[model samples]
Target: MRRRKRRFLFSTVCTLFILLAGLAGAALFFRIQGKIGASRKTPDALFLEYVECLSKADYTDMYRMLDEQSHLNISEEDFITRHKNIYEGIEASGITAQIGQVAEKDGEAVVSYNMSLGSIAGEINFSNQVKFRKEKKKGYQMVWDDSVIFPELGRSDKVRVSTDKAKRGSVFDRNGLLLAGKGTASSVGLVPGKMSEDSAGDLETLGNLLGISADAIGKKLSAKWVKEDSFVPLKTIKKVDELNLNSMEPREDNVKNKEFQDELLAVPGVLITDTEVRYYPLGESGAHLVGYVQNVTAEDLEKHSGEDYLSDSVIGRSGMEALFEKELKGTNGRTITITDSYGTVKKTLAAKPRVDGKDITLTIDSTLQDEIYQTFKEDKSCTVAMNPYTGEVLALVSTPSYDDNDFILGMSEEKWASLNDDERKPMFNRFRQRFAPGSSFKPITGAIGLSTGAIDPNEDFGGEGLSWRKDESWGNYYVTTLHDYSPVILENAFIYSDNIYFAKAALKIGYDDFMSGLDKLGFNQEIPFDISVTKSQYSNTERIETEVQLADSGYGQGQMLVNPIHLASLYTMFANQGNVMKPYLQYKEEPKSEVWLPGACSSEIADRIQTALGKVISSEHGTGHAAYRNDIEFAGKTGTAEIKASKDDRTGTELGWFAVFTTDPNLETPILLVSMTEDVKDRGGSGYVVRKDKAILNSYISGGR
Candidate 1:
């Protein structure tokens, strides 16, 4: 009984001691937790103090609060300079600071605050997160992990503002095939604050994967490094396609710092960003028509202050883009979000959606344009074809054109120089360039004579082979004869392209009547068309001292200027039965609507002109007989314009021209083709030899043959 009592008492005493010790330990633990909680709490007065310090330019205190990496990266002088540069007016006005809630987790604490600068107030809501750890003898110290700045005040009273992401628009061909659209391109960027001793090795490995030199990557890094923050992107690699990006593998060797490594693993600076670039699968073809976009300049910014609502990086330089910029350029969308100093996205503030541009259907036939371009590959020339009735441009071809893709992607200075240095002046639109009309003007003279009744169609005119006479006033001017002095009819004059015949006819017609014909055909007037227009000039001088000068004028030469488009439209009178249609390019949805009407001419005169032109092409002596083809019955004319060889000599270059109209008996549609060539000496009659090759015309006639 005594042994049992002793054992029980000892057990009870041991149990009591254990219970009391546990209770004391619990109280001590609770006390330590309370002290930690109190230390983590941020005082509202601290925010006001910070604002006062900043206003007084207290650099030491500001530097003390910054993270160690930020302190090491930026000097005191630089910190002040950056602050002054970015926020110049912040100091002069009284500021206010408002403290927000404080949050703590693990050994870290976060304090948020709002700051307003003067009357021009804005919000600065920063997330001041710090890590605390014990140091050797010093009890404990705090280290900042990250900081954030944000706009606290709204821009407008509209509280329902929702932010939107700007999705790039798409580009398509006439067939709706993708040309230029949004896609991901591989790039390289850096976070300077995160870079450490191991960063070089990491960068070297990344460079190898990217197929770039380490030095190149380093140079880029050095240029774009952010001193105060690690989240700002530093560099961007251009033109990296998807396949290459997909092959890239992230490894520890490619990202040194643990935090940066995690970031690289998730969202690598050598990341693929969704971007838009101009593309052309047809390569250099249709380059001139499509044109290109380039970086906007200061001058451009000023000129488009209010009008520009899209990208600041691009603008239409030429071609259709320049001609119809307003219709083609769409409004851009924007997104405003509250972000922490580390660029971590907070809540989205506001957004506006982009408006898409309207699609434009061009009148150009791609196949025909390509054919015409190929024809002039070995030669230098321009060709233009149009529907006379509607003035719908079918083809406009200029050889030696540069690819528009190069311009869009950013052309180098050397490439630009090479293109501009070509002697052929490929950049110049020959279709719009001026050239002497030569003998092509003869038909206009004929129209004038007929219109004024100055010369009857059956009147007999004498012709000479080469009429040249010395005149003191005009120098040794010379006139060539039409078909030898025979009683040739009006049709015969055009068939033989009789120079003397027209000269005599012009004399009877009088200058007033000739000028009237010029005005009637849109000469000396601005005509609206898709392709650029170069005004045609007619010489007003009546009499020539030398017979040769008169002969030249009679055959359509000596100071007469006409473009292919102008000359082509002149033949519309014949095709439309004497009603010359005013040429236009804008197509109307409803054909009967007079919104874009092309005025018509008298039908009686058109019939006469048609009859004369038909005889000129089909007749034995016709100059344009070579242009005849079996595919379609056509009326046409050929002209060889004589230009002076030099400033001092009578001999000059010859310009060959051909204007033809395919007449569909059904009258459903009439196609007109005008081709012009300059200085084809070996090829006679203005080098119409190449023009008559019929490749372009055959394609047009046979539907892409």
Candidate 2:
């Protein structure tokens, strides 16, 4: 028993001692590991820290990681500034790195590194060596130099960047007529050295010819880089081609500019030279359709951060230019070169090939577009001309417009102010806008009435004078018409433009049927066109809350607003067997027709309305009789939209509208023209617009676009 107890005690003591030894070993190992972790980085690690700092553009930290010798050679400010100037100038971002082999010799080392940087020239990649020197006190530190920033860069070398501008694509009409394209303009400049001894008089003459003030010319000449012999461009004037109507260039404007150019040549120190320019050949005739491009502002660059745009880049501002900007603006090329103090290229760092913009061909007929613009340029008007069968838009014109070329050539402050300040709202794009469609909307209402089976074409709504209301429940407001015609059938109402007949038809259709009818006709829907316009709506709200509002909506009053393009599309149903054609701007081969609303009305109903439309133009007593032509059979409707604060208030302006098309689709070029003019209240109302469009129709039918 004594031997067993003594053995057990010895075994327990041995186990305890062994356990304590194992714990001591673990503690010692942990202490050694902590020391390793807390110690200064290895030579390769220090270089990696420098590179990681470089990736983040942390120049201050990177400078701190340099050795004493490097610090003595360059100040922290200089180091940071150099890195920032080169990196930011090239728009560098998205840096990635890969560390290669590190070979050490004695106390110094060279760590191989491969880095990638995203820049305007695309991805820049290079493999280089980073030097590390073992310091007396700081351990391993980087040896900093300009070469660390870029392998091709030396201490005194500068990085020179050059941009190759891509050729902007031309815009053409369906017949290959140039709309917006490349052209040359006269660049009027002044050379200080060539000035007369009486330089004051010479400056005055030069300023007058260039349409600039003497002080403005003086300011330009006083620029920091302007030398005595330097030719400082003052302005660019439009050049005209007599044979080119496609450019929509106004002959008078060009002639005036030519006279100025000639007079400028007579002035001492003045130089007139040709320079390439982006031109809207259509000028004021199609200004609202083609749009213009201008130099990029700081705001544009900030908004499009990662885009390819540079400080001096040009961007589309409005119209077709803005609509197709992405495809129309080609990629610009760039080259980054290392240059010496004298600006001689030492090495090429990176380069990119230029990509030219794609050309655009529109379905528009420039001849027709110009003609329509000329007719309405004196007034606030909007017009849309299209081919009813093919759904191809031929012309979109908004008048009281500014020359688009003025934007590219630099418009005067006075001209710009006049446009904005004009109560006519010339800057307001009418074709791209919505308006109270007036009586032109009647055809649509009539078709909707027939489609819903709420209207009988032959049934008489009887005589109700010139104005009417749904019932006594509707107070004050009444549906009004211009003419009171007897036996008011659908066709007869169309001929006389009787609003009461259509109003009664709408009341029978009721609210639910009317709203549903509007939905089928593409109300509250985005029209599938390249350029966006506000959707057509019967009312601002979804539901019709009153009988009077519904009655007014039937005659294209109340809140019945529509886009000219959409209104033109609605008319296509009359010519296309009850199908609303989808209007397209971009030209396609074969000119295929696309149905936007299939069976908006029945074929028989479309024919009945179409026949009534023809009679509206042909009948002697018709409101649209002013546009009757002996050469071509025409079909059309006239509308006068009353803009009133109330039914009793007669001081509001009126919108004159005329929607017309040819009955002969077999003609070489079938056209549907819809025009609307503002402030036509006392100016013959819809007749004013009808007369203006008559000339266009006559010119079109006579092959005189």
Candidate 3:
């Protein structure tokens, strides 16, 4: 009886403890639930949650948040897809939403908010209100519609970006002659209605000829927008007639292309049509300068990701075409609108006005450019012509060039291979490169010597024969000149192009002063021009180390290298009466003379050098006398740069140079032309280049240019 009483008391205490613990657990659970329920469930808060989903681009989550009315209008799958396509299509990002205020109307809660986002066209911002309704089953829920995605959008409206593509500006020469402009190209396409019944074989043939898959073509034909009579353009090709102009028969590859097209045309709806394309009017003559444009590639799109570039857009590939790509490419206009089911625009969300490309007018004279290009088109050469007084670059020519139009129209694989395999390297832009200026560099040395007082205009340096070495430190190397003259004064040195005289003069200028004077003349400095030309360099190293190196430099040989344009610009010092005029290619303002390198020479020294250079063309036995014209006074110099293994080596090739300018300032065409050619050995040396320049000058002077 005693044990039973003890057990019953223990059970009573344990039951009391369990009942108290259960009561406390119930209280804690209710408190947690109350805290969650206490959080704002107002219309503003619920709408903010919906906006939060939009900011994250969580379309599926957004679809679930929509009210029953919205679900009734659009299915869950279509709601998600529409939002995704519209957002991704415009490349939208950085979405933000801020709640402004809340109001109640007609028993419904309206929350006002301002939203903003970024897109490819620009920023898009709007103010809108979202409504929340009280439902019997779900106490409160946010109401949504197409207008919620974008203000003014309707249930039946379509959201899309309409692009108004800007026309690419044309490139014109000084006289308004077109260098690069718009033209027409051939497009290969098919008419769906005329397609063969058994198109499997026909499509295979067409696909192979067009260099695309048959499945791809089939998909294009089956597109909803493509009707039976619709013409489905497949590929763009070169204008057949233009590509085969010079030849009586089409090229082997062209014949193959034509035959392929003919076979396809016989089978089905295949046809050739015309489409607009970019044309290079100057063709091979202005190829290097005008360059060419091609369709943008994936890499191009990435490189210019934030710019107004479309996959089908073209970008400048070379020459001035590339240099001024930004200025030439216009801003494309865009309109994001809401359209109805009938394709009628209902409302515009955002719009950007289109700005057409700026038409670029250059200082290049097409006639002069073409004339100069024709003179050396068959040789490895480069030439630059400019108005010496004004520093306007009139023409820039590089020989053995490829047709830039061919690049735009389309070039065959075999043709591309031939261009690469040709020893001439037609695609190389020679005018933009630097080369040993040879004797053409003599006038710069003369100016340096005369301005630095290292050389007196009339001071005689006695006789040193045709070859002389300073103290025999040069070993077998000796400064040699073609003509032996007595009294090596500045006049005789320039007239005869005496290497020994200039070499001795360079030694007189010493290393420091020579470099300083050269710097003053724009050497080792960036040339300010539209095109990028390599800087003229005096030596490979910072200093002219040895006596032979210094001597050779004085004659424009040694390790000296100069850009053709830079060389042409340097001569402006004489024409401008002591200032190196800044060279320019754009025709923005009046033709004004701007000095590039001031104080390059004193006026007196310039006149003296100018007279001496004139004698170089007029005086009998003068090195440049062969180019003399009785009607016009020409000042010029000739140079033969020897490329030898050693000072005694004679088998090396030679580079010929001729730099000439008209002394007559009042002359209708005052041009300073510089021409250089490789492998001038035994072919009249620098005289060969001189003769070539003379003809171009005569043609230009006679108004042919």
Candidate 4:
């Protein structure tokens, strides 16, 4: 037993010795492997890591990788700033890299790679090389240089940039007359840095010529810490002749005289630079249609970042200008050159020729627009005329208009405030403003009644006298009372605008069919146009508690509101033979037309309605008799809507409206006209609207002839 125990102890001791030996051998092997792994890292791998940092836009990581020599050349802050400038210039948030093979040259390592930078101009792809040197402690470090960002750059070469501004496009009328264009104008101002003499006297002379206060000019030019070269713009004058220097006597007040003008131009601080201004030759004729431009905001810069828009760039603010901004604002060109330290051009590296903006031609006739503008000078109203067949708007005029040139010429705050405070609301676009359409809406009701087979064209209601009242649970059903007209047929009802007869006709059509017919006519639906428009609304039948309420709506007296443009578009059905043409402002546009109520009416029904409309203008007893022309035949309807008075005790004002269309063979297409005058003082009903409508149409027809 003692011999066996001694043998087991010897075996266990040998096993323990072997286990200790194996662990020591493994530790030594791993140590040698780690050293070998460190020695295997080449400059190629270090360069790739740096490129990866660039791909990720990790500037801080890239800064850390720079050698002592590179750090000495550029502080970390300066490095960050330089990198940021490059990123913004190229608009580069991320980079795409194609790594090339790294090779040894003259005991140093060189890496070739391709980089693609994205900018507003386009993607700029280039090839570049990075050089590295071996360091005893650091293993390897890059030799930093400006060429790291752009391969062609050098120590002595500096980058110079120039912008070639593209000329803004011009706006032309149908006759090729210039409406808005770029023209040379005077920019009068003070250059603080250029002024070495006493500016008080010069400023006073300048203020006199510019019609600004001398004290105001002094305050602007003498502001604290103003740079010597800073230009303080006083005004942009388009018609220099209107400055009236010749009319001013030298001794009369402080206004400058013609003789002193030359002296004023010679002043040290005074400046009269010739600059481009957006000129409106037609003035306020079509101001609402052809908007104006304004300076860019910070938000505009952010939104158009890649487009290379400067902070001071001008942009369209409204109307057609805003609608076609992208097309009107042509691509601006850039020229980048390499310059010496002394600012001398060393080489012209790149040049991009600027492409000017394209011109725009409108469908409007400048002659007709100007004539109508002058005709409506005395009235506060709205007028819209369109070709019923083509749906091209010939003239869209709103009274109480403003001269858009005032805005471009830098209108004063006081002037802007006065405009806003005007009681007439001149800036208000009445073309799109909603109003109770009155008798103008009767044609739609008539169309609906005849098309739906709700009322017979020849059937007579036996002339229901003046007022209409039906026995009802709700109070008096007298929606409205009209003057007595014999034989209340569809023809007489429409010709005389007999509300009593039509109200009964709408009730006979039943609530569902009446509303359904309106639906077919596009009531309560969106009228798509280039400019914004308020949707015409109909009374919600779901809440229409009584028949009287519905009856009032049937005769165009209750909750019915429509835009002038929309009303004109709807009238196209009569002249277009049941096809409602889509209205457009731009010329030569083939807008799609839709069939109105295919299931409701045939062409015969539309023709019959056209005849009744003709009688409204040609017939002796017609309400639209004033619009009747001796030389041409036309169809029309008149309306007088009651508008609520501003004061509680005063009676409601009358709104006169007239819708007319002429099928004169002399014209290329049928012209439909819709005119409305609110708060009319004349109680001649539609007579006032017809007289004005006739004058405009007469002028248009006479001019065309």
Q: Which candidate is the best by lDDT?
A: 2
Q: For candidate 2, lDDT tens digit of each residue in 465-507?
A: 9888766877766777777777889999999998888788889
What TM-score fits each model? 0.62, 0.88, 0.85, 0.85
lDDT of 4 by residue, 370-430 (tens): 7777876566778888877677777777777887777787887778988899988878778
Segments in model 1 whose C-alpha atoms lie over 4 Å from true places? 1-218, 221-276, 280-285, 309-312, 335-351, 466-475, 481-486, 530-532, 540-554, 586-601, 645-651, 665-669, 687-693, 703-705
Task: Report RMSD for candidate 1.
Answer: 23.3
**Candidate 4 weakest ten by summed lDDT:** 250-259
Better model by TM-score: candidate 2 vs candidate 3: 2
Residue-pair clashes per candidate: 14, 4, 1, 1
Q: Which stretches of candidate 2 lie over 4 Å from their true place?
A: 1-40, 208-213, 223-228, 239-255, 258-266, 340-346, 465-467, 475-478, 482-486, 703-705
Residues 152-206, candidate 3, lDDT per residue (tens digit)?
Answer: 7877778879898988888999988998888877888889889888889889988
lDDT, each prediction: 0.58, 0.87, 0.85, 0.74
**Which candidate tops TM-score?**
2
| Pairwise TM-score winner, candidates 1 and 2 | 2
Q: Rank the candidates by lDDT, best first.
A: 2, 3, 4, 1
lDDT of prediction 3: 0.85
lDDT of 1: 0.58
State in Å the error of residue 155, model 1: 14
